[model samples]
Target: MDLFFTIVAAFTIFWFTWTYLKSKGKPPSPPGPRGLPLVGSLPFLRPDLHSYFAELASTYGPVVKLQLGSKLGILVTSPSAARQVLKDQDTVFANRDVPMTAKVLTGGRDIAWNPYGPEWRMLRKVCVIKMLSNATLDKAYALRRREVRETVGYLYNKAGSPVNVGEQMFLTILNVVTNMLWGGTVEGEARASLGAEFRQVISETTELLGMPNISDFFPALAPLDLQGAVKRMKKPMDKLNAIIESIIEQRLKKEKESGSSSAVEFKDFVQFLLQLKDEEDSKTPLTMDHIKALLLDMVVGGTDTSSNSIEFTMAEIINKPELENPLVAIPTPRLMDPTLYK
Candidate 1:
C-alpha cells in the first residue's frame, strides 16, 4: 500500500512538471504587474480604478493583462486598441462581463446582460425602434415637459437655500421615466410613493452593481457569495419586483375589464409592451420576465447616467472655479432656470 501511494504521488509531480514545461513553447502573454497567488491584483486595487488602470498602462504600454482572482482582465488604454475592441471587432467582443449581483437583479433576462443572440436582437428592436423611437419620444414629450416644469418649480421654491442639484435631477428624471413607463396605470399619490421607493432601491441596486463580487471572479465560489454583494442586492431586487408585479397585475386587470379593443386613452410603454407580448411572436416571444427586466434596466440605467452626469458637471464647476473665468459659462442668480444649461 505504501509503495502504491508513493508511486501515485511521484506520477502526479511528473505530470505537472511536464505540462508546465510544454506550455513554455507558447508566445509570452501581455505585460502586467505580478500579483499574489490566489487573489491576484484584487487586494492592490484602488477605489479609483480608472486612475489605477491609467497608471498601469504607463508601465505596461497599451494593453495590460491582469489576473483578477480566477478571471482574466485585459486593459486597453490606447485609442487604437479601444477601437479595435469596440468597433473594428465589436461582434467578437459583444458579450458583457455580467456581474453576479446583476444576474440576480435582472434574473438574467435584461438586454444589458443577455448574451448577444436572437433574444438580444429582439430586445434591441423593441426598445429602439418600437418603444424609444423618435416618434415615441415625441408622444412622451408631455411627460418630460411636466417633470421638468415640476423640477423648475421645486428649484424656484427652494431658492436661496442650499439645494442638492443631483438629487433633485434624479427624482425628476425618475418621475418622468416612471410616467412614461406605466404612469397612466398608476396615478398621483401612488406614483409619487412608488417613485420614492424606486429611488431608494435604485440607489442600492446601482451601488451593488458597482461592487466587486468575489463570486464573479471565482465562479466555483459563486454559491458561497463570500463578499455578500448578492445577499445585499436581494432586498432591493425583491422590493423593486413587488412594485413592478403589482403594476403589471393592475394593468392586466384593467385590460380584462375594459376589454381588449378598448382604446380608452394614451398608451404608455408598458401598455405597448403588453400588447406586443400577447401577439406571441414565435421569433422572439416577449414574456412577463422580459418586461420586468427591461423596466428594471430602464429605471436603473436612466437615472444613474443622467444624475451622475449632472453631479460630475456640478462638481467640476464648483471644484475648479477658474474654469468660469468669463470664458466658461458661469452659474449665477439669473441662470436659475435649469433649461438654460440645455
Candidate 2:
C-alpha cells in the first residue's frame, strides 16, 4: 500500500510537470486564477456561474482565463470583446465547445452547437433563410390564432382553479410549436401528459447541458463517463428522438396514403422540410438525422426559451403590475374592441 501510494503521487507530479512544461512555449493566457494542476478551476466553480464569472472579471480583467481540467475557458466580459466574437468576427468564432449532453441530445447535427463550416452554413440557410422567410412565417398566423384560441378556451374552462402558470404556458408553447411543425395537435389530457414528459425532459436536458461533466473536461475519460452525465442524458434524448421518429413516420404514412401531394399542398414545416429532404440534387444534402435533429432543436428551443421568458414576465407583472390585468385570466368577449387574439 505504501509503494502504491508513492507510485501514484510520483505519477501525478510527473504528469503535471510535463503538462506545464509543454504549454510553456504557447502564447501567454490572459490574467486569471492559477488553479491547481490536473483539475484546475473545476473545484472553484459555483452554482451561480454568472455571478462567479463577474467576480472573476472584476479581479482578473474583462478577459479571464480559467484552466478547467484539461480544457481552457476564456471569459470575454467586455461588450467590445463580446461584440468582436458575436457580431464583428462572428464567423471566426461560430463553432462551440459542445457539452456531452448537448451532443447526445442533437447528435452534434444541430445548428446551435455544430462547428462552423459547410454543413453548418447549410443548416443556417435551411433553418433561417428558407424556413423563417417572410412568406413561410406569414403562413403561421392561422396556426398562432388556433393555438391561442385553444389556450384561452382552456383558461375559460379552468376558471376559479389554481393553475401552474409555468407548466400551462410550457404546454401551450409546446403545442403551438408542434402544431407549427405538423398540423396534428393533441388537446386536454393528452397535451397535459405529453407536456409533463417534455417539461421533465427539457428541464433535465438543459440542466445537464449546463452541468460541468468529468467526461467533457477529460476527453480521455469521455467513453467511461465517470459522472454518469452521459448515461443520464441518453434517457431523455432517446425519448425525444422517439417522439420525433413517431412524428416523421406518421407524416410519411399520411403522405403515402394521400398520394404524397394529391392537391393538398405542403402546409406545415414538416412537409416543407421533407420536401427539401427529397430534393436529391442539393449540394449539401439534408439527411434524416439532420431533419430529426432540427425538429428536436425546434421543440427544445421554442418551448423552453419562450415559456421561461413569458413565465418570468408574468411573475414580474404579478409582483408589480402597471395595470391590474392578470395574464392567466379568462377574457371578456366583447366584439367592439378586440385587442387581437380574438
Candidate 3:
C-alpha cells in the first residue's frame, strides 16, 4: 500500500507540473484576473458566468482570457473580437470543449457538443435542412401560434389572480417545444410529471456544465471525481435517455402498425433521425446512443434557451412598471403583442 501510494503521488505531481508548464508555454493570450497555481480562476465563477466574463471584458478590453482550473476560455465581448473568432477563425474555434458529464450525457455524439468534424457536419446539415429550414419552420408556425394563443388566453383569464408569470412562461415554452418535437403537448397531470423529469435532467446538466470542475483541469484527479457530479448526473441522464427511447419506440410501433407511406408525412425530428440512421449514405449509421444524444441536445438547446430569454424579458418588464401598463394595453392583437412577441 505504501509503494502504491508513493507511485500514485509521484505520478499526480508529475502530471500537474507538466500541464502547468505546457500551458505556460502557449503564446500570451488575453489577460484577466491572475489565478492561483492549480485551480486557476475557478473560485470566482458565478451562476451567471456571462456576467463574470462581461466584467472581465470591461477591465481587460473586449477580448478577455480566463483559466478555469486547466481549461482555457476566451471571452470575446466586442463585435470586432467576436467577428474575428466567430467569423474569421470559426473553424479553429468551432470545436466544443466537452467536460466529463457532457461526454456521458450526450454519449459524446450530440451535434451541439460534439467536436467539429464530419459527424457534426452531417448532424448540423440534417438539423438545418429537415428541422429548421424555411419550409419546415413555416409548417410548424401554426403549432407555435396555437400554443402562444392558448398561453395568452390562460394569462388573460388569470389577470386578477396573482400568478407566477415566469413559471407560466416556462411551461408555455416547454409545451411548445414538446409539441414541436413529439407531436403532443403535455398538460395537467402528465405535464406535471414530464415537467418534473425534464427539470431534473436539465438542472443536473446545467449544474454540471456551469460548475467549476477540477478533474477537467487536472486529468490525474479524474479518478477521484471529488464532486461526485459525474455519479449524480448518471441517474438523471439514464431517466432522460429512457424517456426519449420510449417516445422513439412508440413512434416506430405506430409507423409499423399503420404500414403506410403517408405516415412519413406526420414525422417529427425523431423520424428524420431514424431515417438517417438507416440511410446508406451515412458513413456511420446512427446508433441508439447517437439518437438519444441528439434528442437530449434538442431538448436542452431548444427549451432552456427560449425559456430563459422569455424569463429575462419578463423580469425586465416587471422591474420597470412604467413600461408595463402601456405595453400590456397596446392595441395590437393579443397574439401579436410586441411587448411579448419578441
Superposed model 3: Cα runs more than 4 Å off: 1-28, 31-33, 44-62, 260-263, 333-342
Score residue 176 of candidate 2 by CA lDDT.
75
* TM-score of each candidate structure, all chains considered together: 0.85, 0.87, 0.83
| TM-score of decoy 2 | 0.87
Best by TM-score: 2
Model 2, residue 170: displacement in angstroms?
1.2
Candidate 3, residue 181: the lDDT equals 74
Question: What C-alpha lDDT values do all the predictions have?
Answer: 0.82, 0.83, 0.77
The stretch of ten residues in a row with the least summed lDDT in candidate 1 is 333-342
- In candidate 3, what are the lDDT values of residues 244-325, reduced to their tens digit? 8899898788778878425566677777777667664777566767778777877887776777788788888889998799
Residue 249 deviation, candidate 3, in Å? 1.2
Off by more than 4 A, model 2: 1-16, 156-160, 319-342
Per-residue lDDT tens digits for candidate 2, residues 221-303, read: 99998989988989988888888898888888888998864346656777777878887557888988888888888888899
Per-residue C-alpha lDDT of model 1 across residues 1-342, encoded as one tens digit per residue: 999999988987886686469658887779998786557799989988999999999999999989898787889999999999999998788897789998889877899999888998888888997668898789878878777777677677788999878777787888777777886523467755766666678888999998878898899999998989988999999998997898888888888899972375677778888988988966789998999999888878998789879889878878888865764555566446556334
Order of candidate numbers by lDDT, starting with the best: 2, 1, 3
